[model samples]
Target: MTKVNVYVTLRESVVDPQGIAAKDALHKLGFDEVGNVRIGRLIELELSGTQAEIEERVKKMCEVLLVNKVIEDYSFEIGEVAGK
Candidate 1:
């Protein structure tokens, strides 16, 4: 089995309301050092395939369903499962 870790984040130009709210809450909690806390999504996919095939498929999945290419960016890491 293969383990693919996908990260989806808002573009730099996009406004992240959730992140801003979280930062504000943190500041209220005395975490004044927190700054620009951008929120993102981490999606883990388990599949059976060759590295190249899995990479291609995961990219397609991101483009088609997992990420919003218009206002977001995505990246992924592919690795083999130890005991799968």
Candidate 2:
């Protein structure tokens, strides 16, 4: 089997209001040393399919449902797992 790791984050040019808000909230909550906070999504999948097939399916999923391409960018890594 293989394990795929996906990371999704906002593009550099995009303004992340949520991140700013989180930083502010953290400051008020006594974490004054905190700086910018950028939030992202991570996903892991275990598949028994071939690498090529998995890549194709993952690309489709990213374009259709996993990410908002207009505002975010994503990268993924796939590797064989030690066990089923």
Candidate 3:
């Protein structure tokens, strides 16, 4: 089995309202050290395939559904899970 960790985040040009709200709330709570904040998503998938096959499938998955190409950018890491 292959473990895929997908990280999806808004593009730099896009505004993140959730992140802004969280920052504001943190400041109000006295955690004022918080700077510019951005919100994102992490998708963990366990797939059965060889590394190359998994990579191809994951790329397709991201392009087809997992990520929004217009405003979001994504990256993924492929790894092995021991004793699976």
Question: What's the TM-score of each model vs. the native?
Answer: 0.94, 0.76, 0.94
The list of candidate 2 runs beyond 4 A from truth reads 80-82
Can you write out model 3's per-residue Cα lDDT over 1-84, one digit (the tens) per residue? Answer: 678999999999999999999999999999989999999999999988888898999999999999999999999999776456
Model 3 residue 17 CA deviation (Å) reads: 0.2
**Candidate 3, pairs of clashing residues:** none
Sorted on lDDT, best first, the list reads 3, 1, 2
Question: How far out, in Å, is residue 52 in model 1?
Answer: 0.7
Model 3 Cα displacement at 59 (Å)? 0.6
Best by lDDT: 3
Cα lDDT tens digits, model 1, 1-84, are 889999999999999999999999999999998888999999998988899999999999998999999999999999767466
lDDT of 3: 0.93
The candidate 2 region of ten consecutive residues with least summed lDDT is 75-84
lDDT of each: 0.93, 0.89, 0.93
**Per-residue CA lDDT of candidate 2, range 1-84, in tens?**
789989999998999988999999999999998977998889887776788998998888899999999999999988777496
* Per-residue error (Å), model 1, residue 23: 0.2
Model 3 earns a TM-score of 0.94
Worst 10 residues of 3 by lDDT: 75-84
